[model samples]
Target: MQILIAGASGFLGRRLVSHLRDAGHDVTPLVRRPPRPGEVRWDPTSGVLDATVVAAADAVINLAGAGVADKRWTSQYKQVLLDSRVDTTRTIARAIAAAPDKPRVLLNSSAVGYYGDTGDHAVDETAPAGEGFLADVCKVWEAATGPAEDAGTRVVLLRTGFPLDKDGGLLKPLYLQFRLFAGGPMGSGRQYLPWISLPDWLDAVGFLLERDVSGPVNLTGPEPVTNAEFSAALGRVLHRPSLLPVPGFALRAAVGEFGGEALASQRVLPGVLVREGFTFAHQTVEEALQQAVSSITQ
Candidate 1:
């Protein structure tokens, strides 16, 4: 398979490129810089991409976006978050639509924030859009894939959860905090945290590439855990004590607008993945945390 991916330099994108290439798939990355061998150049901010490039690929996976937690969500940075995702997705969708021969599928990125703060309730793909800044961003982000989907291209909206790995995602800072014996749950710790192991996330993307499925797919683990449970599991895995609990106000003070979201409850389930018979190697939060920790030491 020939796969063209936007945001190929990101944490997940970099790993995905290696994973696909290891599986013997031809992967071409979309870059903002000058083109290198086996790479495509496109300015997504300006919606500049050759339709021929879209036509040449068997599949296109877009993971492009400004990092939500990268900086304080000022009104300016908030717009950056929206534009980065919506503009990039719209660019690819338009290119795919304009192509004489469209790619077989478009796997665009989204987030579980589409469900807002679900509290104790569990949600699947069928859930309606939620309210809030992140929710609004996700709605527009997913809708940006309209052109490709309307053009009869199979479009998959990857409503990803928190991916657990030693190198990145929400785990990095927490790992450091635990190492310094200052780690604990955030806020009430009762809020559900939808998380998936890095390996399962990679495998699920590969699975969807071949499966005859479309629309919103939640890339979360089968069993969602509360923030407290997750913190405890991480502490156990690292042989550290999980006694401290950060209040919501402190979190908000620490990370600004992203803190509210950091404590947001989302009991998201991988309904599509499970219904389609996708298997997870790590079913529990503890298991996932152990694997993540061991991966670092090994």
Candidate 2:
């Protein structure tokens, strides 16, 4: 398959490129800088893009977006988050629609944040959008794909969860604290965390590319754990003690609005993936953490 991926330099996108290439697929990355040999260059914010290349792709995955947790949620950063996601998606979708030969599948990225604080409740794709700033952003984010969807492209919204990796993910920060002997649960540790290992995330996206699936798919693991449980599992896997705890107030003070999400309880289940018979390479938190540590340290 000839796959075109936007945001290919990001944490997940780079991995996807390698995964597909190793499997004998043609993967062309749409970068933001000057064209580098095989890569396609375009800045979505500036309305620059290669429409013909977009149209010719067998499959297109737009993972382009600013990281929600990258910075403190000042008002300025909030707008940046919105523009990065909505504008980038709009640019890619428009190009796909304008293409003479449209891609068969469009895999757009979304997040479990769409569900907002679900508390201990199990959320599936059938669940309605939850409340909060991130939820609002997600609603607009997925809605930006209407152009491609209306153009008869098979649009799949990957409503993914926290992707576990040792060197470059949500785990790295916690790992640092752990190394300093301050590793423990954040907030009350009761909030449910929906997560998936990097391997499963990549494989699941590839599976969706081949299957006849569309609409929102929850790309999370079958098992969801509370913050405390996740902390324990991660500690066990890293062979470190999990004893310290970050208070809810401290978390909120540290990251502002995003801290609300960090402490928010969302137990999203991979309902679509399961019903579609997609096999997961990793299931439990401990399993994912162990795999991540071994793979990265190697």
Candidate 3:
């Protein structure tokens, strides 16, 4: 199968590309700069994508978006977040719609933030949209796939949680801190932090790519843990002591509204994946951390 991916240079996209190639799929990266071998350049910001580019893909995966945690969320950066996701998605959706031979699947990215603070409740894909900055962004971000869906494309929204990659995702900094014996819970330590091991996430994506699945799929682990639980698990994996906790006020002051994301509770579950018979290799936080540690060591 031919897979066209936007944001292929990003953390998750980079790994997905390698995994897809290993699985014998032809992976074509859509970039903004000069095209590399087997690559095509498209400018989402300028809204300049060739129709031929979109028509060639058996599947289209749009992972292009501003990093939610890249910088402090100022009023301007908030708009940047919205445009980066909604605009990029719109660009690809339009291409898929206009293409003569439309792709069979359009897997657009979203986040568990769509459910906002779910407290202790484990909300599934059927739950209603939540509130706040990240939630609002997710609402618009997922909605941008309307064009492709209307054009008879099978659109799948990947409402992902925190991806646990040793090199990049959420584990890198935490790994460093654990080595220094400074690892600790943030805010109240009661908030849920939905997470998935990178390898497991990659496998899940592969399972969905070929299967007849559509609509929103929560790309998270089967088991959700609290911030305190996550901190303790990482510490145990690294043989460190998680004795400190960052206050909610301090966090809010440091990163603005983005801090609210860390402090807010969201115990999300992969309801769709389980019902579809998707198998997960890393089912718990401890198992996921073990693989992450091995990845770092090697």
lDDT of 3 by residue, 1-298 (tens): 9999998999999999999999999999999988878999988998777878889889998899998889999889999999999989999999988999999999999999999899999899999999999999999999999999999999999999998988897888889988998889998899899999888899988888998999999999999999999999999988899988888998899888888787999999999999999889999999999888985666
Candidate 1 backbone clash number: 0
Q: Over the full model, what C-alpha lDDT does candidate 1 score relative to the true structure?
A: 0.95
Candidate 2, residues 1-298: lDDT per residue as tens digits? 9999998889998898999999889999988777889998888988777889887789999998898889999999999999999998999899988999999999999998899899888989999999999899999999999999999999999998988887676887887787677899988899899989988999999899999999999988889999899999988876788889999999899889888778999999999999999998897888888887786556
Report the backbone clash tally of model 3: 0
TM-score of 1: 0.99
* Model 3 pairs in collision: none
Question: TM-score of predicted model 3?
Answer: 0.98
User: Candidates sorted by TM-score, descending order?
Assistant: 1, 3, 2
List clash counts for every candidate, in order: 0, 0, 0
lDDT of 1 by residue, 1-298 (tens): 9999999999899999999999999999999999999999999989999999889999999999999989999999999999999999999999999999999999999999999999999999999998889999999999999999999999999999999998899899899999999999999999999999999999999999999999999999999999999999999999999999999999899889899988889999999999999999999988888888896757
Task: Please provide TM-scores, in order, for all candidate models, with all chains considered together.
Answer: 0.99, 0.97, 0.98
Task: State candidate 2's TM-score.
Answer: 0.97
Off by over 4 Å in 2: 296-298
lDDT of 2: 0.90
Q: Which candidate is the best by TM-score?
A: 1
- Identify the leading candidate in terms of lDDT: 1
